[model samples]
Target: MSYGDDSKKKRRLAVIGVSSLLLVAMVVAVTVGVGLNNDSNENVNDSSHKSTSQVSPTVKAVKAICQPTDYRKTCEENLQKAAGNTTDPKELIKIAFKVAEKHINEASKKSKLLEELSKDPRTRGALQSCKELMSMSVGELRQSLNKVTDFDLSELEKLMEDVKTWLSASITYQETCLDGFENTTTNAGKEMKKGLKVSMELSANLLGIVSGLSSAIPSMEAFSRRRLLQDDLPVLGHGDQFPTWADFGTRRLLAAHVSKIRADIVVAKDGSGDFSTIREALPHIPHKNTKPFVLYIKEGIYHEYIEFNRSMTNLVVIGDGKEKTRITGNRNFVDGINTYHTPTVGK
Candidate 1:
């Protein structure tokens, strides 16, 4: 071969070598791209799998409110983050205050929901249940407030205002329900009245759920005034703690029957003819006392059903035991009625 041809041939061979290297680089690039795409797809799948693995914290938090515990720790933690506080109760208080405000807002929403439900017959029961649920939420919120040691007064005041507003609405709803029940005349109407009565009793009991450290809360004031009146308060039998029949009676007899124990009504099995029945005797029961007409039944079987009216706040029943003395009645649901809806086992 000539020298020129040999030089051309060498150039061509170098060109071929450069082209081969370029091809190899392109292959490696393509492989890397495919690998990256697979990895990305796997990452997406893993993320979806993780989401399916468990319930969200929001759901858990919402559920926790209905649970027996107050979830104060969770509230404290959440408030801490939101209000930007660490270590000091002031921060915790700020957080607590915010949480309480949030709860109050939620209560307003729930109250509105209830009002709407009341307008719609289909939702009445559900609305009533919602009120019960919110009552518990109110309790948890109050408990959180109780845990707070120190907080900003201005913020606390604002939050308390919200709570008071909700309480006012609740009281109105409760009283309205009681009045409706009280006015009903038919048998079914009376049964409905019983349900409302139970609800009203529960509503009254929930007043204790609030923590009124100060009179800043109006509901607190209502409860306080009501409590004061309880001293000379007539008992209406809504499940309060008191001494047993014998102890209660002995104390009364010692005080003076016609004077100190000069109650409008009294119930005792030791009296003439076993005080008739609990129902017949309820009418004779006086509303003049500062406490319930003391019904001290001696240990015996008193087969009857009993209930206290809305104004009957201090009805004290001293039973011997769940076994020894008895208030027995056989009422059940399968008889085309709610087990809770009965006329004689009435209120």
Candidate 2:
């Protein structure tokens, strides 16, 4: 070959060699980057799978427990988060009660803050009512918790009744809190509603679990009959003067002789009893009555709007007859009296 041709050929070979080296380096870099990315993704997938696969025992239990509830997702999330990995049913129940109690207490606190934020009197009143009702609900929840904490499946009648009553009361109090805000255009209602929503759900969940507690417990059905058969049959019996609704206490009171009724105050409106008017006798009622305080309202058309408030607990006011004893009042919404304050007899 000639010298020029050989030089040109050498230059071409050199250029080809450089291009091949650069192409190989680029391929290797691209392959390594892709490999690294795939490895990173694989690691993430493995971690995610591991996390989901190892479902906690408590989570499983919560799901099972809340399956029959009205608010399943809420119950599961709340109970699962609070109880962690424990699977014990009793412990789960206690944890559920605690969760409800805690949330209700927090709502009660928030209602006070909401009251402070609101300037409208009606809103303030509603907030105050919410605070009071939430407070009562918390108290009822605590009572239910205590019963569940050291309860008797053997005394199924009393235990079940008590638990059901308290839980129902708690749920009712929460509803009452919301009800006060109803039929009004108040922003506080939304805040109060939002604040109380979860607690109410928790309370309902607690009640549902407790209602099915017989099945949850081992061999509770066998002994449930013992107490219920003996105690419940008579109470459930439909008969004579006492209606189905009246309890043994009220039935006994209604059946008792007039002479047996021990009265702390009496009203006759004819200067025959302890006081002429019902309002006059209210002031004489004991400031604090742990026992039953009987206020015998005689047969008369009393022209007064009576109200028994929070401080007056266990005051049994018996009248002559439903038709015979009449309470009349003229104060009404149309006559300038506020609707709330216009009730003839309020408690």
Candidate 3:
């Protein structure tokens, strides 16, 4: 071969060698990428498995607790979402309240929309009533939520009773909303009914849970009695050692006379006392009394309801006894008063 031909052949060989190196580098890169992708997929699967395992126990706990509820599926879903992995019954109850609150709020919004869209007079009236009822239900659920954390096991029965009463009233109000449209035949009423059904179901389920739990548990009073019998007496504080509000004269009289009276005002049903009636004496008290003012109610039934406002601080009522000095009234929810405002004696 000529010298130029030989040099051209050598150049071709060098070009082929470089092409082979490039091909090897590309193959290695693709292999490394595939290996990394497999590792990433394995890691993702492992993480998913771990998360699911962690959540399984919580789901089981929620299912067990919610099994007895009227709306078990709904209770499980809502409690699972709100409580995450917590298995505490108290926490579950709180979450149930929150879910009920949310449901009621949504129902209230829907009712308001129905009220606004309602053209027929009867439908509008019904929706208006429904809106108010839903609003009240939301308020009651919120109050229950606020008080749940403060509940002592000893008072569980009372708490459950109160919860059941409020929720039952809420359910009744929802039914009443539906009843308002019983005689009517309108799409608006149907729509409102559809919107309120979820909220009603949620409230009913909460009530069922509370009732079931209360029934299943042993009497808290019995538990308390056992505890009191077993536990030592707690050390008394300074306030417990002596009466905080006794005046010097009252304190001196306590040493001499076992039954002595000291009061800022005396109210009696008979005309023999300083005031003939509580209503008459209420006006005579100071508007913003700083010190403690005692209102001594004598032994007689006062057929009147009394309300003390926030400004009436430091005023204490000293009754002869709960049965002897009675304040009676006929105010109630049936009288078209809001349940919250139907209290015989309220602040």
Candidate 4:
């Protein structure tokens, strides 16, 4: 070949070598880019994991508060749901009671609705009892809620007592509502029992928490579960005639002899007192009072059922003797009356 043709061939060979180098560089760049994209995806995944691990402070507070409760899971979940940035124990308790109130009211409404479906007289009576008792349960829960909200540190002992009493009674009322269903051959009893189970459990759990308040509040250090659990409650004494927790009105009434009581009104089988029947004397007493009002009963086996409503507060009834002055009731479940309504004395 001539010298010019050989030079042209060398130029073409040089161009081919440069193209190979360029292709190699592009391959290296693509590999590096792919590695960087994978690293970026991994970083995004790490951030996502970090986000899921985070928890709300309010939820943390709820879990912590309900940790010691008997129904911890239920309490925690519900309180968490209703908890809106509240870290205050009192507010949490109030919220718990509010939740309980809602559940109890739901049970009450269920009882009424169940009543409409029941044809059995016993079932009807039980539903009626449940309706009334659930109302009482709601009232007691409200009382507890209010006390926790407005309680004074100076009166911590009384506050604990009142809260304990109210919460415990609410649980009892819920149980009593179910009790009315027993021995009946209808599905209503079972239904009501199922419906009321949660309400009762909530009340019980709240009572336990209230009983444990001494551990949480420094001011309640003087109170404890031991004092609350005494079998001899309405305690006669700590070595005295009566316990310190007894109200003045209660102490006075319990200590007083029949002769010492001045009658605001009297009931007798004989035509000697203000009225011949105890029922008649009920309306004569004041609808409300701050001081104790005494009603004296003369000796006789009176065939009557006595009842007092919520409005009749601070009233005392004294009988001549348990054996001599007797009150009798004719109500029974077999006679289509609820056992709740069968008591000789109902409050």
Candidate 5:
């Protein structure tokens, strides 16, 4: 071996040393990057797990409450949003009621659109009836809210009675609204029906909750004693004579003694009283009348159409008999007019 050979061996040793250092550096960088990536993935997964683990109390409460309802998914989704994080049963029930109120308000607004778009008198009349029914439902729901706000644990019976009455009335109003659209086949009618059906289901669910709460009330001796001491006794009647469907107020109105009740406006064909046609008497009555405004229709066939507008409140029309005091109109769907606009009796 000479000096060149020795120099070549030195170069080769230096090159090998440099190459080993570079390879070590590369391995270290790769290991560090892989560890960092693994840590980042673990942190991401942990964050996702934590978020999922923290389910809202209100969401659970809504799910539990709405589980037994007719519209479980609808009730849960709506009520969960309304309730936030509240888990209290009473609060949950109140939230459910609010949801019901919201749905009914939307339904009422939607039904009003039908009236505006209606080309037929009958369809308009039906839509008007739907609107009126929805309005009544909203009124009853408001009344229910008032009662719920005033609910007392001591006077459980009274509280339960008021709740049942108002909620039942609300349900009935929605049912009546759907009944108005029974024979409708139009797209508008279908949409109205669908909207009202959801409202009705929501109303029914609220009513069910009220009823369930009422049933859960403990029957203490005090409640029984109070009931026994009450002066106003339940009336007994023949099964066939008394209508099971009539409410307390309606029953009182239908009593034979109520015939003596004076009329606010009287309509007679012979011009014996205030107005000849029912239409003439309507305008005379005050708009947004708070008190009961009764109209007495005399026995005679009146060949005229009648409409009670939205502004009229608490207006009651009484006749001698359904057949004896009849109102007949010529307008119909076949007369090149929208059926909604053709009703002899419309709102």
Candidate 6:
């Protein structure tokens, strides 16, 4: 071992020691950086989770409107309030039906349409549909009422009550529309024409609702007492035998009774001649006749528009067969035609 050799050994040893210290410092710094980063990330996640848990789902304000405890009083109050706040016809109709149902006289129950309402299921269904329409109309009226600024709440309530009475009378009239005219012919023939005529009147203007109803009640009561309410005579028994229309037996009886009204002329279309539009014949119909212009439409399709003035009262358009006969016209809400102007397919 010489002095030069010792110096070289010390230099090598120093170099090895410095390299070991540098490696240890780097490992400690990396461990501390990773631990701090994990703690910060955990805090951020916890805050985010708490926020989500505290949040709530949104609710609608309109749905908060509560139903009334006393359906009558509540309906009346809500109706008045809604009418004052809105002008929706549907609301008015709602008030109307409620009023009618509540106030309907038990002893004075009358309606030609209602006479068979229980016996014929179809009449009941039609009545339900008519009621739904009335409700919808009232809703629309409610919306309109809400928009009016000048109406006091009490005034609106009173007016709505009156409207309800008028509508009730109208519905009753609709029921009795068929009972106005009588046929001395076979019971079935008479009843069928009556049913058809009642349907025709109902399909017309809603204005005649009160007058038509006022006249119909007494007639139904009288018919009920006489057992003449069962208009469908000759109860065509189970499909054992079929009767031909040309036999001239039932047909003659029907023609004789219906013709006496003097307000109608039936022209059966045999395909040999063209039909004059409803527009053409309406002018000739007399107002003084207070009778329907009965059109005994043959089983065929009539594609045209039909319009009737106030004078076209007691009108009836009957088809030989519902399936073979169609009176179709397309009019929608956007077409500017009133909801009542929509076309119908009837028998």
| Best prediction by TM-score | 4
Winner on lDDT between 1 and 5 is 5
Predictions: Cα RMSD each: 28.8, 26.3, 24.2, 26.4, 26.8, 35.3
Return the TM-score for candidate 4, rounded to 2 decimals: 0.75
Quick one: how many clashes does candidate 6 have?
A: 37
Q: How close is candidate 2 to the true structure, as a TM-score?
A: 0.67
| Alpha-carbon runs more than 4 Å astray in model 3 | 1-55, 219-221, 226-347
Query: How far off is residue 48 in model 6, in Å?
Result: 68
Better of 3 and 5 by TM-score: 5
Candidate lDDT scores, in order, read: 0.43, 0.72, 0.65, 0.74, 0.68, 0.38
lDDT minimum window of 10 residues, candidate 6: 58-67
Each candidate's number of clashing pairs is 17, 0, 0, 0, 14, 37
Q: What TM-score, computed on C-alpha atoms, does each candidate reach?
A: 0.30, 0.67, 0.50, 0.75, 0.58, 0.27
Model 5 misplaced stretches (Cα beyond 4 Å): 1-56, 107-136, 151-201, 217-225, 228-232, 235-260, 286-293, 308-316, 320-324, 330-347
- Among these predictions, the greatest lDDT belongs to 4
Candidate 2, residues 1-347, lDDT tens digits: the string is 99999997886575445433332333344335544654667656987555644766556566656655788788988887888777655567778888999999999999899889888676676778777777778877887787666544344445656788889999998887777765555688888789989998888888777766534333435543545354655643345665554566766776777678987888997789999998988778875566667889888899998988656865778887789778998885445333455679985
Per-residue lDDT tens digits of candidate 1, residues 1-347? Answer: 99999997886575445333332333344335544654667656987555533634333332222122134344434443454423232332334444544544454355445446354332343344334444544454454444333233323333344444444455454443333322223233233344344333323322322223223334233322333343463332224343222235444554453433443444456665346466777776565445446665545666777765534546555544567666777655334333233334443
lDDT, residue 190, candidate 6:
48
In Å, residue 196's CA in model 6 sits off its true spot by 33
Model 4 error, position 15 (Å): 95
TM-score, model 6 to reference? 0.27
lDDT of 6: 0.38
Residue 281's lDDT within candidate 4 is 84
Supply the global lDDT for candidate 3. Answer: 0.65
